[model samples]
Target chain A: MPCQILPPYLLEKIAACERPEMAHAATAARRSLVHDAPLRRLGDRSLATDQPSPVPRIADPAMPVESGPAPTVDRTVSDAEGSENLPGKIVRTEGGPVTADSAVTEAYDGLGDTWRLYWEAYGRNSVDGRGLPLDATVHYGQDYDNAFWNGRRMVFGDGDGQLFNRFTISPSVVGHELTHGVTQYTANLVYQGQSGALNESVSDVFGALVEQFARGQRANEASWLIGEGLFTAQVHGVALRSMKAPGTAYDDPVLGKDPQPADMAGFVTTDSDAGGVHLNSGIPNHAFYLAASTLGGYAWEAAGQIWYDTLTGGLAATSDFAAFAQATARAAEARFGGSSAEHAAVLGAWKTVGVLPG
Target chain B: MKVYVSRVGGVAGIRLTWQVRVDDQPDADSWWRLLEDLPWQSAPSGPVQPDRFCYEIKAEPHEAVIAENELDGPWRELVDRVQRADTDSR
Candidate 1:
């Protein structure tokens, strides 16, 4: 704060000023330098940064340099013009005024919320943890039915509007796609079989967390819905998947029924969807819900930290449901102690979801 | 010959399948050419990205799995044509 009042140049001059009347000014300048020093060094990565960057957080005079990142929120939202072609036109950028296009504004704000959850809750810089700029494309296709992470950027479709609404309508869905980028950088889980399900589950876990963090909802108050508000009124569903009750999110004649399995017993064994990545993920999703809700506070605080640790704790890319359960268990113990309630909650949650031994 | 395309592994986790009886269509020659012109040599292989659709195509004797992200010009056209033909026949 003081850095803005006294420019670094002015502070330097004042620190060097030997006038007896300016002794306090020199002392204050030295303190500001220490307080404003960047806690984490940002690396040089050649990212597409055509938009305006965040207002630089100058070193404040009265604050200590905490262990959080310097907080870079570089976002770019483009439009596909109803075509499959990517990033058709730049419609919005970081810190820019809201656009008339609802999809573009929703995406920009959603990306910002996702970035905030990772940065504030876990102190992560971006998807790559290196302050990688986030880019998204909306209106990806005419009557398209899905959204996805293309290994580089998030792409959202204008849903057919018969069964689904626009993909950017729900913040959780945007968070879900962006978390795919997170999983790509962290565990890089093999996108097939149980490991693939874990990949999906991890995304859903943090996706819900992003929404919760933004809404300031406690664990109990949260919806635990992954794609809420994406379905139209005609679709008889509250969301695409419910962590609390996996297969109960939707059931409609046209859209069929939600096929997710809550625990291992009902887990669908199929060759579709990369060995049912979307189906089997309900197991871990429920596990996270139980752990977070059981702790009964901010879901992102204790439960989220454990999951974040396990994600970056270097599990194998081929980690299965059981291996992932073990990793989360160990992560909870490492942070909250084996005797602590947090570790117990994680183990209990996984056990309830049939991913761990009872 | 018959062609079947199934799209799977998207954010919604739903499978959508479309098929066409290549010989039954009035545009049979174009369908045949599109089916045969697939770039079989350059299949997608690398670290798999999350949530992108994986399309599985099954023809009379040939089958291929293509990632949506890697779906090139030919892949997109084949899918679009089959979807259109399937819708018309339905």
Candidate 2:
């Protein structure tokens, strides 16, 4: 699934508004809709037919073909240069000198940070957990206010600079997009309804974790905001989504309010956004935040480990919120004793989010 | 006749609508001919792929909702023209 960082509802809000300040946002939203519609259709066809994603897998030109225990971070960053074409021109590779383009440098560093987080924390390789060379394209389109993983590689857009900055400015944004590939290889969660929301939540979980791990921030110390720096001063938003407080992340005259519901009672019943995958993900995201905060230490150690385990530990592709909660509880108990604080915290967190019975 | 085309679905779940009066179109007869030839009445209804688009077409007394991939021939052309019209207006 090619999951985008910004949801369509926000774009629609901007497009429908008549505010003079939002004219650029409206144009950007319209252009993004037009460009993304066909690409999304193509992605759906591949998924429906079980054909490989239209995004071809490109091997790293820098890395040699060798089979060993070498934990190498093979990252290749390309420049789209304001065009929609992807993997445009290879601007920087792993071990290469930094380019003058800040987007390229930020993308390269972000990919490396994500790789280090997974490698050092979970011993997992790249996205596929098998040393799949990381590839990213920066400056993907003309003020295209979104970043996505097209099943094979990451693509970042230079934002309109009013409501959004460059997509690569936030490492969690990069992690969030790349983690879709992780979900693709792991549970391969069906990207619709409750299961789809779980898929989105899992990405957010690791995305925040990746940022936390890179910054050495404890759960309490972390901001718990995804895409923190991606938003400009004009947006009147802290970030794109807040794991700590999902619905409170953003509320602007142009972008409207973040529509994420933090609990089951608020679960949106919508026929769009893959059944509100981005909207309903707030429930589970809040759950993770509660668990991590309650555990009161480095999140990537215990809470992050449990979520990672549940994700890779034979979770069903169609697992709903309750099923996912139960899986995480079981994983916590398996990793820690049933009487351990980790298990109790995991169960308590789910209950707090109304996914599990208290 | 005024034709309204609205697209729903895709990753963001946003609905995009474009309205154009067919009578004002440069190729009004061709547009009507294409619209009439589409299999609008028989379009299936059920779960579609997460990112695939579903289009709702409305022209006064006639309306139909069709999935993007299922659309072919004249329906595709109608959609293309409507999208182009919307883009041009923007």
Candidate 3:
């Protein structure tokens, strides 16, 4: 056997740091990359989940591809039945008739809509840019109040009736979860510090685009709010977070104020939530909103396309906000011309957010 | 005795916390038992999945950042009880 300097677990601890520039951490990440399927996942994954996660579905080339006029959207929905188990029982699949349970129908349609947004706008087939089947589980745990993409698939919770409703109620939330999977297959930005925030912002950007596309709304016409209908009437909030104006999404005695910062001046620094990935994401969220709204038409046409290109083109696992800003600027210039308003708008948005110089 | 739980992460990325004053409860011993059952010597450490809920639990130096799926038995009971307490997460 090859000499083992440190235990595999110790190597994992170093790999979890995921800072590619750090020689020790990078070597550890590279070593851990082949330790096991699950450990390799953490090499570029957003979450350092304790439990073993389900393996991502790889497209089987051995299985023949079905060519047709329209690409098939394969979605599978499951019912957890108030348990924490994922994909508990398959309740619905592609082309299945709507179920009596609203959660089931909503999840199915939401998954389809998210898949359609990626396909229709970017010509991306699915989360992996391959025909990876989409899977989602609903009614997970009793009165569970959050939704998530657990590396392999989406899991939805029925919100506590006191403060929130079913998670499937919002299209943006669904879009957001699915985009995490997209990020996993693309840039796979390390889910810590500024890079984690960029990973989050990328999801929010496409999440908003998915909602806007579904509604056929112009960039300026869109709500620009994520989780718009997730809150109960009792909660004093319009949405979970806002792209147009961050920190102003909600204010209530129960949930407190929205903690997002719209610009670098207000950027929050912390160790929680993977270095405040969700909190600092507001900075880029607002930037995309500004660029899309300034363009005055469908966001997917220019602003969204630029962001999409930047994401798919990939970045270092440790790309910070400034690096992401420069990449988007280059993408905009390449697609829309260096002198075009699209390029100018992208640069101006980043400058306004303090990610780039004015 | 205060048992604190703050759930962060998920797609929403908001932090919601619950601080239970176990001393205030008549069944303080029961609460203590649950708190003691948790792994306090070292926080459960590992890589978390994207968009999964991460909980920060603290009863003073006894703190851990646990992913939602890892929560079981006492951890689950404490969180569920704290949540059902219906106190606002300030």
Candidate 4:
């Protein structure tokens, strides 16, 4: 869901000051885009593996930029030694080559910061516990409004330039994509049905934590909104997605209401896109949001701990929502006593989202 | 080495692609077998193209550099400490 609500063509019409006609066209376009069959069931796919042909690697030493001053970038998630550049350093408008003040730079900085955060805060070097050369592709498609960790590299679209700004600019978005890599290494959560949804939720949790840690904001002091600053003035949505509020993220008439279901019972049962993994993610997304808020501090410090443990531990890969909830509870208990605030936060967060751990 | 995994139906019906680089020479058969053993569902078919021997996993997204020794105990301890400290109250 990294793309903007309004498609570029329509936004262009509106930006061109075609008040009545362009607005009407944009509205119609939005409706069609929303109902666009492929988009509705995004990320829905049966987990089937294909043998990849090995493409020969020709190591070109020529592209080598001097490895600046021995580990110039701490490359650790929490190193705090790297530049304290703000997350919004990269910004892009109109889908032109990435501007220094555009979303791409922000994404690059965010990715590097997140990597450093994990390293400094936890001693973890990179997403895979290895120094993975972080690669990201910004401005993927023309007005192509989505950011994805396409399994190899992070690909971001410029957003239609009207409603959505640049996907790479938001630290949360960068975190979201990078967390996908973490999931891949850990549970490799089945990207279908409830399991798929949990995978998405994990990304959301970690993504928010990256933001909270960078800003030095505690849970209460934080907004708990996923893509708060992503939308422009024309966007009628609150953010790209709301972990705390779930379905309440947006309710604009033209863009259609947010379709995330916050409770287990309300879990969406669909087969369109990998069993609606992204759609059903709302339930777990809400759970993590509540857990972090209840824990009441830097999310990456407490709530992030439990979730990360669950992911890397035996609960990986095949774990579903119920299983994930149980695992999180166990992790909390193992990390903190069963009655500790962190443990309580874990339990309360799941319950708030209608998931009662057994 | 660039490994390409093609799932008949990828995540959300979109083809899922994972590319990884290994320091050693590329081995197709080994990579395919490894991918087959991955936790997620993998396409069951003949080798798509270049056949070599290597470990493979159905890739989803993101990037990483594995130095073989990276997953040793020291790395595990480092990750575990981070996980525990990041979540436990200061």
Interface RMSD of each: 1.6, 4.4, 1.1, 11.0
TM-scores of chain A, one for each prediction? 0.81, 0.81, 0.81, 0.71
lDDT of candidate 1 at residue A22, scale 0 to 100: 70
- Candidate 4 local accuracy as lDDT? 0.57
DockQ of each: 0.52, 0.17, 0.54, 0.03
Candidate 1 residue-pair clash tally = 2
After superposition, the stretches of candidate 2 with alpha carbons farther than 4 Å from their true spots are: A1-70, B1-90
Weakest 10 consecutive residues of candidate 1 chain A by summed lDDT: A37-46
Better of 1 and 4 by lDDT: 1
Candidate with the larger TM-score of 1 and 3: 3
lDDT of 2 by residue, A1-358 (tens): 1234567777668756657677546544543443344355455656687643454321222222454565879999998889978779999988999888999999999999898777666657799888899999999877666777877788888876866789899988888888888888888899889998898888889989889877767799999998888878987788878889888887877667778888888989986556778889999999999999999877887788788878888899999999999989887766554666989999999999899977
Error of 3 at A266 (Å): 0.3
TM-score of 2: 0.73
Model 1, A1-358: lDDT tens per residue? 2224666677678756767677546545543432332211111111436523322332212122345446679999999999988878998888899989999998999999898788656657788887889999999988888888887888999998877799998888888888888888888888889999998988898989889877767788999998898889988989989988899999887567899999989988887677889999999999999999898877877788788878888789999989989988887765555566888999999899888889
Error of 1 at A109 (Å): 0.6
Give candidate 1's TM-score: 0.80
Model 1 is docked with a DockQ of 0.52
Q: Pick the candidate with the highest DockQ.
A: 3
Error of 1 at B45 (Å): 6.4
TM-score of each: 0.80, 0.73, 0.82, 0.59
Pairs with backbone N, CA or C atoms under 3 Å apart (clashes), candidate 2: A8-B12, A273-B13
Best by TM-score: 3
